[model samples]
Target: MEKLNESMAWLAKQDGSLIVGHGPFVESSEPPADGTSFYVQDFALQDAKPWKTPSTVERTTIREMTMRFQNAASISCGWLPLDAAPFSVVFQEVMSSIHSGIFEKTVPVVTETGMADQPAGFAIMAAMTRQPLPLHSYGWIDGDSGFSGATPELLFALDGTCLETMALAGTARSDDREVFAVDEKEIREHEYVAQTLVSKLLDLGNIDRSAREILDLGSIVHFLTHIRLDLQSPRTPDELIRKLHPTPALGPLPRTAETLSLLFEWRNRLGCPKQFGAPFGLLDEGKFDAIVAIRGIWWEKNQVLLPAGCGVIEASRLVNEWRELRLKREAVKRFMLPL
Candidate 1:
């Protein structure tokens, strides 16, 4: 690998190994017949050629990569606090739709912007590589612009005839874990996501849905339910991704075209990054592992964006949802700091 200044992509696997693609990457509409290919797509799944064949690929541990990363100069950026008025408007619209039976749940994002003195790609990449286990570190950097983060939500992992995914929702501060575990409103929000995911995969194969549990990530906690399936037959990566991309966790509960359009309009109005909440993955041979592209930083030159989303249900309170968004953003900020 050359350095963070060049184009590169990476996805960490469940086995504690990181697959890194050293660029210049070649764009492809189909997965490579051999070797590893990094998959990158926008939240709307608009990219037609989402596969990128790296000039070089390497498998390494996070610790090894962290040591090789050169520490860049301290990044100095002034961040603006996100205004709550806009989010409140979107919240009202979402609640109205829910009451009208158009949607059971929907996630709306709030983005905080900042201006850096210089490009921050190297620093952000280095920080993400330092994140500990249970959180998968992923990134794609091209020149002075890119995104990187350590995310806890896995979209899915396919190995031969088996597939693994999880429903990660219902966020709360780590201190409030005990109360959050039994909170009725939070539980309902989580169940909406878990049940929707199961319904989608029921026809695919023999399914195993684990009991809902709490995932504690230092400053924050979320409800987590692991789901597995033994497919009756093989399925293509693209097919599986399209079927599961915007799960209720990151998309509308009743995922219809009209509902998704409304959600996209709200997201655009809020200035959400196109790639946030999208599927970021790596296809190595026949296996694939993808993670939800949340809890990350996106930048172009000196401009930086930190976006966080809160799932809105009929029972969601504006004040509580606002607080939850901030909690999520703060957790991402922690990734930029030394552990």
Candidate 2:
């Protein structure tokens, strides 16, 4: 534990430029479909599941030489490690330990929500440490669904005066069954997200709000609402990023506090990994960008890796939650799986 604290302290000291980050990937099944650009490799599991049809999925491995954050992305920090699940302990611990909010946790629901639990192949971090990452985050109960990618559609580069803080709020399913919009309240959660994101983005930038507009991302068929803002100043990447994190996709609604409490309050009990999953994919960002990191797996060591699920809210149906997790897992499968 002391070693973990020491590393966290060393990382907090700023030396490299602070920036936004995100992470991991899906299982080694369902290879990437056409149209998507970001696909990952679960190469570690190449030989393990050769005989299987590929629908197979599992948890992560333990202790390995990981260099994710300042390096690449890994699953070291997820729920598979200490078995504590980041319950209440993760949240408070992050505040004191990592100086981070957006507390994350792993929970065992009343029903089987299909999110990855144990782990599978390895996806370890193999880089060296750098500097503390800049961060800004928010969370809201998604009365509707789970995102395909962690903040799926990423938006970077300068766009006039406005900083484009946007994501694809991808599809949701557990075991391949839809979970999000069951009715009015459910669908409303996603709508709340569209507006909440714009508000959050504006809060971080020094720009005029009234001048904002809804722009097209890529495939119009994708069910997502994009919002762009004009920053009043050149937001040092750190500041801009800090302002755009933990959007409604993570919290703010009723269950948010309870959900958040799970991380900080019960964190110790869960006993998951240390910084390995802390900022899973928040390092090495471009100019003001936010990567959702929804569907992913942590590469721990040569044969150890872990996958996790995001618990939405009570409104989130138990069975539906299971399907959402499956979809998320499948998202990562694209690059990992093969013909």
Candidate 3:
């Protein structure tokens, strides 16, 4: 592995290629008409210039990218146990809202913090790049502060008139796969996401929804339903992102301005990173692929933050939700281990 000592951004595509952008990057509202650009935005979509023009761009295989990352030194990092009281409060509020008909489901986040012995960007990036298939590696780094992860959730991939996306929800340990598949609460949660996505894209064009299935990732698993659409007309990347982002998988069931504002409040109270669950995508010419920013680590110097969210419905229990959060965080930590 070669040592890397510069600011950069990258996304692993489904086609077995990695698009890397070396920065000092410039921000733009519109993508360059005939080249590659990275799309980054906070959860709130506040940035007007979400398109980043890298100083230079390269297309390479993930294997090649992995070789370029210098092996990060072994360093001790201690994490603080997340307090459950706050999450418990949020859970109760979410349940009340569901019962009152304001929301059928909502996802609330919990963040865990740690202090590392040294800067952790290289270590995190190296691990993410080495992740195996089904987990697309992605990240943005600028010196001491950045976030990186290998996420399983694809927001969408638009290539010409065809678009591909998925509804990924319902989590369980691999050991509980049998029971989880039959669990009513888990099925309902997954259905909420899959069905909502169908409704959102119905007017676009021909739609195909795959049979629900399980996606196994060693220790963790999730219910996955693939959805594809053939658009009646061309659509801009920004328009599509706005229409489908924050699906019930990660946002309120009946997404509304009011509900979104409330969800943001809960996220802020729990110290969730602004970019968590946001859409991170790449624009190559006219093609675009975006992934949900989850299962990742954020850092500022030696301070590290890990955030995970669980969908809460009336049938959800506080203890189970808290356990799910920890499970998600642990899965991310496993990425830091040597491949």
Candidate 4:
């Protein structure tokens, strides 16, 4: 607590580039990657941006990160009225796509807009401390446009010749453990996520992973499987990230035009301001790690938007899927929203 408070105190004072370790896109002029020797600028594969592999990185330490936090100018958070109609429309599209055989699995992210009376520092602290999951709190403030959130899904991480990733799907309220544990719809959805990722990984390396298990993260639970990739040859973290990003968890499987159309509809009708799983990358020591920036907050001007998502399949119900999306937001709300 003392360490966190001190970090916050330091953060309230300074300005310029702010990159909080192990979180989504913060302000760092250099390419976004983890550690020295190797760094990747666009790990999230944002549109046409190409991957950058620089020889060196301006190493970010805990003290350096603390200094970056000090750089943010003081500001109050606020909210705006959210139109919930788009979610209904997007939900309908998801069902339509699944039934038409365009997608076996699709994920749609919904945003809840509002304001925060507190400082960005407090929000970051609350998220890191309150969430019991592998949740990592992240934030960035540049002029008036900034975003922050607690993310539990790791896109992929590279440590030497071994690569690590997970297929996270099928979310439910934490208390209803059995529902998530045994529900057929949830189970099939979870399997699709894992199977799709495994097939993608097989093209790049040899796979060694355990069976899926329930990974309970306080307010929410998900079907998760920790994956390890033993490279058949050798591949950079950058190489593996490109192949694995926007997994079925955030977009669609098979990477087909029909499946991607759902995402376009989401952005056009549902008001998804940016890509869901694209936000954060970290290069620490010699190891590199990056996460899908889901289940977090996006801040611009005085407005704050909290976002959450769920995988939709043929068997998914409208009411249950909507409830699952809300529950994912509730997990984030525990920290971002005032008690």
Q: TM-scores across all candidates?
A: 0.97, 0.44, 0.97, 0.77
Q: Write the per-residue lDDT of candidate 4 for residues 1-339, one digit (tens) a residue.
A: 222222111111011222333222223334455543222222235444322233323333334444444433334455465566778788887788778878887778777777666535444444433333366544433335555565778888777777888988888888899866988988898888888888988876779878889988877788998888887777765567667767888878667766676576675456565645673555545666666777666655446777777788888877787788778876766654433
lDDT of 3 at 333: 91
lDDT per residue (tens digit) for residues 1-339 in model 3? 244446788899998798889888889998888788899899989999999988888888787766665354555689997789998888888888889999999999999999998887778888888776799999988877899999999999999999999999999999999999999999999999999999999999999999999999999999999999899999988999999989899999899998999899999998999999999999987799999999999998889999999999889999899999999999999988864
Stretches off by above 4 angstroms in model 3 are: 1-6, 67-72
lDDT of 2 by residue, 1-339 (tens): 111110010011122322211212222333233211121211111222111111212211111211233333333222222222332333334334322333221232111112232232221111212211221111111112111112233433343355654433324433222333344434444555566566566555553323222222221112355555566566643344334434545433322545445543342344322211121122221222234333333332222222334344334444454545444444444323321
- Where is model 4 more than 4 Å wrong at Cα? 1-44, 47-83, 118-133, 337-339
Q: How large is the C-alpha RMSD of every model relative to the true structure?
A: 1.3, 16.4, 1.3, 6.5
Model 3 TM: 0.97
Model 1 lDDT, residue 255, Cα: 95
Residue 339 lDDT, candidate 4, scale 0-100: 30
Better of 1 and 2 by lDDT: 1
Over 4 Å off in model 2, which ranges?
A: 1-161, 167-170, 173-186, 203-222, 251-261, 264-288
